[model samples]
Target: MSDAARRTVLGAIRHHLREARSAGDELPAVREAGRGPPPRIGEREDLVREFATRLGAVGGVAWRVAGIDGAADCVASIAAELGATRIALSDAPLVRALRGRLPASATLVEVADRDAIASCELGITSAQAAIAETGTLVLDAGMERHRLASLLPRVHVALVPVELLVADLDAAFAAYATREVPAAITLVTGPSRTADIELTLVVGVHGPQALHVVLIDGA
Candidate 1:
């Protein structure tokens, strides 16, 4: 879309918001009037288990490791299992540790080009946060920055810190409320999949077919 078009749409949204507020047409729900309070995950809930279980339910794989070292090992094993000869990686501190760890025949790559990303069978990146309730990986998106690596490969490996896990979207947004607005936030729930064809299910239609998450607690 053109900049003018974008601005027009944004202006319309702003006008709509102003009109709504002026009209006071929307009702605010209050817990005092019998409505229950918003739901939240238990404070003592095991986030690791919850995240992993929820991920599996949506066709994503998750592994809990002790720290970055264990996560590196897990990524190597997973790559080997899939017979991956080339793996694309983001320049994340933790993911970069796997550079020299893959099998001698396999290569670990970190580049921003499409051709470079396409050559790799697996892609590795890090998440800003992981939502335990819905098993989502949230990334701070930029214009095609790290998009090719994650979206072009057959398999995607995401390294996320366990401490960054949130109970739900509400909690996720709350954490960012005090921070400056991000350019965009990408929420990945599972492997790229769509069944828009003649009812035949398809995977990797627009992104990676397999999603693997490595959660590091000690990082």
Candidate 2:
């Protein structure tokens, strides 16, 4: 672009920054700090296990894996255990690895339409990241094509990379900010749940009835 155009863009950005900073916001001290919950840092194995535990606590099942092959095995096993005859698996490498290997007893569909997957009993995909505090799985549109790939099916299986596990929401936000724009970003916590009627709890009223989180490590 021309220098004039560049200057015009920069001027607008600077103006916006000036307006934001001049809003009389409280400036932080040089070393501002607060006492909050301690960060839950752990090794890959420990973190993956904790992630599985949280997913389970929120009415979702979780599996642990050492690598891609193990992940593939877990996927096949889950499909079999659930008695899912038709399943939709995402385009992620982890899901792709299970393509031909899944039991022939079930029909494994790849890159199928979300609505088609909705008709099936299972759907699997990889997550962009997962928030531990809220037990949320972050699904970036770019990685999974559409958020509904994980949401609209009866049973959803999510493959979460151990390295992408963040301790809390703040960390999740930071991780999201660094990524390119996606068609959508979904933060899913457990199955679709609501306490709408007289504070009574209900499940599978809105989204998938079951969520399976497979936390993959060292891959």
Candidate No. with top TM-score: 1
Once model 2 is optimally superposed onto the true structure by TM-score, how far is the C-alpha of residue 81 displaced, in angstroms?
1.6
The segments of candidate 2 whose C-alpha lies over 4 angstroms from its true place after superposition are 1-46
Which pairs clash inside model 1?
none
Candidate 1 residue spans exceeding 4 A from truth: 1-41, 142-145
Estimate the overall C-alpha local distance difference test score of candidate 2.
0.78
Task: Give the Cα error of residue 51 in candidate 2, in Å.
Answer: 2.5
lDDT of 2 by residue, 1-219 (tens): 699999999999978877877996655656556535555555665655666677778898877788988888898888889898988877887677777877788877675576677777888889888877667898888766546568777888888777888877777766655778777778888898889999988888768889888888777
Span of ten consecutive residues with least summed lDDT in model 2: 29-38
Error of 2 at 105 (Å): 2.1
